[model samples]
Target: MTPIRIRIGRGGRGRLSARILVSQLAILALTGVIGFALFAFAQRSALDRTYEERAVAIAKTTAADPQIRRAMQDGGGAVVQAVAERIRQSSGASYVVVIDLHGVRHSHPMPQLVGSPVAEPIVARDGQPHVGTDQGATGRSANGRVPLYGPTGELVGEVSVGIPERDVLGELWHELLTFAVYAAIATALGAAAAFLLARRLKRTTFGLELEEIAGLLQDREAMLHGIREGVLAFAPDGRISVVNDEARRLIGLGTALGSTLDEVLPDGRLRRALDGTLTGTDISVLTDEHCLVVNRMPVTLHGRALGAVVTVRDRTELVGLLRELDSVRGLTDALRAQQHEFTNRMHTLAGLLDIGAYDDAYDLAVESAGAGQALTEFVRGRIGNPLMVGLVVAKTTVAAERGVWVELADDSALGADPPQLRLLLTIVGNLLDNAIDAAGDGPPPADGRTVRLALTEDERGTTVRVADTGPGIPPGARESIFEDGWSTRPDRGTARRGLGLALVHRLVSRHGGTITVSEGPGAVFTVRLPAPAVRPKNRFAEALPVGGDRR
Candidate 1:
C-alpha cells in the first residue's frame, strides 16, 4: 500500500526571523546615517566657534602687549613683525598681521606682503575686537582682529590672528569615529532583538505560516458545519468554545458559544451525558423533542489537556422505526402461535374423523374460532382506535404462547381515540412488552403469571398503567430502571436491550408527561401524558395499522 501524504502551503516570503532582522537593520542604518550627518554639521559649527574665540583671545593679548604697541608707534617694521610671528608660533594660529591706520600691512605670514596695503578697510579702528571665519591669503581660517595702540593710548594700527579650518576638521573626524562605533553596536543590538521577537512569534503560531493558518481555519469551519453530526467543542474551563450549526439545531442552543453547559442545559441525563458525568461511548440521551446518541472524547495536545469534543447524532426517526419493527415481530410471533394451535386442532380433527366422530371435530373448530373472535371484539370495544386494538389482540396472543396471561384492567376506559394516538401507542406498547417479559421470567407468581394494562382518557390527557406479577423491582434499581442501557434481564446478545423504557420515558416527557414506577407485589409502571395546548395533525392516522397479519 502506498503511504498517504499531506501537504501544507507556506508563504513565498523568506523566514520570519531573517526578514525581521533585515528590515530592522535597514531602518536602524538609515536613522544612524541621518543622525551622523546632523552630528557632523553641529560639531563642525561648534569647533569653528571655539577656534574663533581662541583667535580673539590671542589677538587681544598681542594688541595689549607694551612692546607691540611701542613698535607700532615707532612705525611698524622688523620689530613689529618679530613680535607678531612669536605670538603666532606660540598660540598655534595660522597668521598674525599688524597693519597701520592707512590700510597697509606692517606684518604678514609672507615676508613679501610686509609693508603692503591690506585688501580690507581698518575694521578694528574703533578699538573693539572682531571674530569670524575669513578666507585669508593662506587658507580659510577663523580670524580675530583688535586695534593696536601706541604709547599714551594712541591708536596706531590693528593686530589680526587666524586659526586654520583644517584643525577644526581634524578634531571633528576623531569624534565621528567614536560615534560610528556606538552606532554599529546599537544596530547589532536592534537586529538581535528583532530576531528574538520573530522566534517568539514563530513559537506562538506553532511554526505555521500565515497562509497555512488561514487555510486551516477555512478547512476547520467547512468540516465543522458541513457534517450531519452535531459538534460541540469546549474549553478547558468548561465554557463552550466552538459550536457548529448542527450542534445548535440538535441541542436547541442558538448562538450559545462561550456559555457553560450548566447555563444552557438543565439538570438531567442529557446534561450529564454532555458534561461527561455519565461517562460512556455512544450514550443515549433523550431530550424534549429528540432522541440523541452522544459521544465525547477529551482532546489533548502534547500531554496537555485542551478540553473535550462532543458529537451528537439524531436517532429519533431510527428509534421510531425500531419500535415499529418490534411491533411487527410481535405480530409474527402471534401468527406462529395461532398456526401451532391450528395444526393441533387439525391433528385432533383427523383423529376424530378416523374414529368417525364428526360432531366433536365440528364443535372443536367452532370453539377455537369463538375464543379468538371474543378477544378481538373485547379489545376493539374497549379501545376506540383500531391500531391500538390490533396491538392488544396481537400481544395477547403472543403472551398466551409463552404461558403468560395478558389482560386489560376492568377500570380501563377509552371511549374516543386520544389526540396523540401514535405517542399513546408507543407508551402502551413498550410498557406491555416490558411487563410481559418481566412476568414471564422465573417461577409463576402466586396470583398467576400475568401482565395487566390500564388506560384512561379524558379532557385533561391520557394515562396508562402497566403492572406485572413478577419479581418486584428493588428500591436501588427503581430510579435507574427507566434510564437508557440499564437492564435487569440477562444479556441475550440477539437484540439490544434496555431501550424500551428509555424510549417510553422520552415519549412521555415530550408531551409534558410524567412516568413513575412503584412496587407492591410486583413492579407497576404508570405514565400520564397531558393534552397539548393545540392538538397537532396526526400524521400516523393515514398509515397502515401496525401488527398486520402476514399469513
Candidate 2:
C-alpha cells in the first residue's frame, strides 16, 4: 500500500530558506535600481563640471593667440572670422565666436551671422575668464569666455568657446553601461550570498520554520513542567542548564540554573546518584527529608556529547507504603507460622487423647503457651515504646519461621518513648531485618543460627546493636554494604534490595548520630542517635562534610 505523508505549515507555502532568499533578491534588485538612478544623476552633474573646465582652458588659449587678438583689435573683419574658425576646429569646440566690447559677433559657425551683434552682453569685458552653460544655434553647450588682449596688453575682444552637451551625454551613457554591469555583478553576488546564508540558517534550525520552532518550544515547556517526574538537564561543562518546576519542588532547589551539582546538592548518596558517579538505573537515595528514585542518562547528538539528563521521582510516600506492606507481610508470615505450630500441637493433642496419653498432650500445650508468653513479656518489659515492642515481636516470629533464632539482649532497656520514635524504628527495624537475613543465609551454626539485638537509652541518647551468626561480611566490603544498591546477595527481582542499611545510615546521620559496623565472627552493626534537645542545629550540613571526607 502506498502511504501519503502530511506536512504541517508546509503546504501551499514556500520553505523558510526559499522565502528568505526571495526577499533578499527583491531587496537587492530594488537597491540596484535606486542606486543606478542616483549614479546617473551624479554622473551627469560631474560630466557638466568637467566639460566646463575644458571649455575655459580652450577659450583662454584661443584668446591668447597673437593672430586672433590682432584681428579683433583691427576692428574685426574676415581675418578674425578665419582665425576663430581655425581655433574652433583645432580645439574640438562646437563654435568659437570672437566678440567685441559692444557684444557684436565677429565670428560665427554660420558665415551669415558674422559681424552680427550678439544676443547677450560680453561676460569677459572685465578681462576675467567666465564659464557657464549657453543656448546657442548648435543647442545647449558648456561655454567659457576670455577677454582678448592685444600686443600692448589691452583688452580688445573676447574669445568664447562652446563644447556641445552631446559629448557630455555620450560619455555619461558609456560610463552608465559599465556601472550597470558592475551593479548586476554585485546583485548576483549578493543573491548568492543570501542563498548561502539562508541554507546555513536552515541547517542550524533543523529546517523548521519559525512557527514550528515556536510550537516546539511551547510543547517542550508544557511537557517538561507538566510531567510528574522531575527533570534536570546539564551542559557538557557540568553546569545545570534546564530545570523544571517539579524538579525544583522534588529536590528543594530554588533558582539553581547554571550551577554545578556540588554547588546545589550536598555531598551524599543523592548527589552521587545524580552526578553519574554512582551509576545505576532507578537508583534509590534517601535524603534527610525525601526518598528519591533517580535515573541518569547521558545525552548525545550526531556523535557529540551533550552532557546528561537526570530524572528524579519522589518516592517518599511510595517507600513508606512499601515499608508498611513489608511489615504486613512479616506479620502474615508470623501468623502462618503460629497457625502451623498450633495445628501440629492440636494434632499431637488429638493423637495423645486417642492413645490415652492425655498427660503428654497437656504438657505440650502448656509448654507452647508458656514459651510464647515469656518472649512477649521479655520484649514488652525492655522496650518502653509499643511500636518498637511490636516490631521486635513480629521480627522474632518471622525469624523463627525462617529457621533463625532472634534474641533480645538481657541489658537492653528503654525508659520511655523517644522524641524521634519513627527514626529509631527505621534504624532498628532495618538492622534487625538485615541481621535475620544474614543469619538465615547458610547452614545453621553449631549453636543454631541466632540474631541478637541490643537497645539502650540514657540521658545522652539511644543506641541499637544487631549481630548475626553467619558468614561475616568481608573487611573490603564493610563500608560498601551501607551504599545504596550494594547488596551482598544476588538480586531477587524488580524489588529493590540493599536500601535497608542505606536508609538506616541516612536517618542516623540526619539525627546527628553515628553508625558503625564490627566483625566479631559475624557482622555486628551498631547505631547511636543523639537526643532531640542535643541535636546539632545543622545536622545535615555537618553530615555532608563527613560524607565528603569519606568519599
Candidate 3:
C-alpha cells in the first residue's frame, strides 16, 4: 500500500481528502451552470439575428418594386388582392392586407377585409422599408409578424409573417435533457468512486480489514477517551503498558509506559487490580474504601496470555450517594416501627374499656390518646415485608389523621430478603402520597373516603396498585401528573409534592419496568417490574466490616 501525499495540518488525512472532494464538486457545478446559461443566450441571439435579416431584405424589395406601387394606387381591391396573395405565397406570410391613407381596406387576404379599414400603421423609414413585426391577423396559421409599406411610403396593407416558437424551444429542451443525463451519470459515478476510495484509503492508512470496521474502531476509541474511567493495560508480567488519559490523571503521572505496576499504582486499588489480573480470572474487585470497582481480564491467544487489561472505575461519589440512600431507608424503617407500637397501645385501651372499667378505662384511654398524631406515628413503624405494607400503613395513618380512611390490600410474596423490596417501597410511597394529596383540603372523601393500595407479585414480576376515593384525578391532570413539576397541590408548603411520582417513574424505567395511570373520578396508578432472573451478590452486606453483620 502506497502512502498518498501527506500534508501536515489540523485537518487530518480523512478530513483533508473530504475537503478536496468538496472543492472539486463546487468547481464543477459552478462551471456547468455558467456554461449552460451562456450557450442558451448565444443560441437564442443567433436565431433572432437570422430572422430579422430575412424580414428586412424581403420588405426592402417589395417597397422598391415599381409595378407594385402603381397597382396599389389605381387598382383598388383586384390589384391589391393579387399583390397580397403573391406575397403570401412567395414569402410564406400567413396574412396580408392593403389599404389607402384613409385606412380603408383596398385588398384583403380574405374577400371580407377588402372593404374594411387597415387598423394598423405601415411603420417604415424614409426611402427604407416598413418592416415592423407584429402578431399575424385573424385566424392565421403562424404566430410571428412582419409588416411592409409601399414605395410612396403610403400605408400599404401590412404583410405579417408568423413563425412557430418550436424551432428554438426544441433545441433548448434537447439541451436541458442532455444536461440532466450528464448530471445523473456524474452523480452515480462520483458516489461509486467515493465508496471505493474510502475503502482503499482506510485499508492503506489504518490497516483495517473493512471500512465499517475502521469506523467502529474510531468510534470505540473516541468513547474510551470521553469516559472518566482510568483504564490501563499490562503485558502479563505486571508491567505498566498502555495507559489512557484518565488513568494518567488518576495516577498523577506524565507517562505510564515501561513502568512496573508497583511504581505506577503505589499503595492504591490500582496495585490490587494488577495482582488480580495476573490470576487470569475475569473479576471485578472493589477497593477497601468501596470507592473503586476494578474489572480485570486477560487478553489471550491459543491459551497463551499475551497480555491483560484492567478498567479502573471510580465509584467514590457513588458510594457516598448509596450511604445517603441507606440513611433514608433507615428513617423509613423507624417510621414503620412507630406505627406498629401505636396500634398495639390503642388496642389495649379499647380492650380495657370493653371490660366495663369505666373511670379507669376512660382515664387510661384519654391519657394514651394524648392529642398527639398517633396514626401518623404508627404508619411510620411498619416498614418491612411486602414493601407496600409500610408505605400503605404510613399513608393510612396520614389519611386517618386528616379524617380520611385508607384500606390497603397487598399481595407482595416478598420474603425478608426480596431484591425488589426497596424499589417497591419507592413506587408505592410515591403513588400513595399523590392519592392522599388529591383527596383535597376538604373533609377527606365524604364518609367512605379512603385511599386503597394493593401489590401483587407473580411469575412475570411485581405490580403495584394505588387509588384514591377523593374527587378522582381530573381527566386533563392525569397525563401531566407524572411530569416532573406537575402538581395538583400548587399551594402545598415549600416541600415538593410533584417530584415524588416523576422520580418513581424514572426509577421504574431504570429497572426496565413500566408505570401507567388509570383514568377515573379518582386517580389510580399501576406499576410493573420485570424480576431479574439471576440474583446479584448483596453489595450492601459486603460493605459491612469483616466481622460485622448487616442483618
Best by TM-score: 2
Ranking by TM-score: 2, 1, 3
TM values, all candidates: 0.68, 0.72, 0.33
lDDT order, best first, reads 2, 1, 3
Worst 10 residues of 1 by lDDT: 542-551
Error of 1 at 8 (Å): 11
Winning candidate number (lDDT): 2
- Check candidate 2 and list the clashing pairs: none
Per-residue lDDT tens digits for candidate 1, residues 1-551, read: 11123332445434655666677778888998999999999988999888999999999988988888888898876888888889999999999988889988878889898978988889987778888888989999999998888887899988889999899999999999999899889988887887788778765565676677699899999999999999998888999999999889989997689999999987878888888888877787766667789988887655567788889999867765665676667778778878988999889988988998989989987897899899888877778788788778778888888888998977787855578787777667677778888788847966789988998888898889988887768767777877776777654332346777777776677668999999545788889889889777773542322321110
Instruction: Go through the candidates in order and give each one's C-alpha lDDT.
Output: 0.80, 0.81, 0.56
RMSD of 2: 6.7
- Better candidate number, 1 or 3, judged by TM-score: 1
Give candidate 3's error at residue 225 in angstroms: 17
In model 1, pairs of residues that clash are none
- Model 2 lDDT per residue over 410-491, tens place: 9999865565676676677778778888888867889999999999998888889889897777777778778776777765
Candidate 3 lDDT trough over 10 residues, lowest sum: 542-551
- After TM-score superposition, what is the CA distance of residue 48 in candidate 3 from its true location, in Å? 50
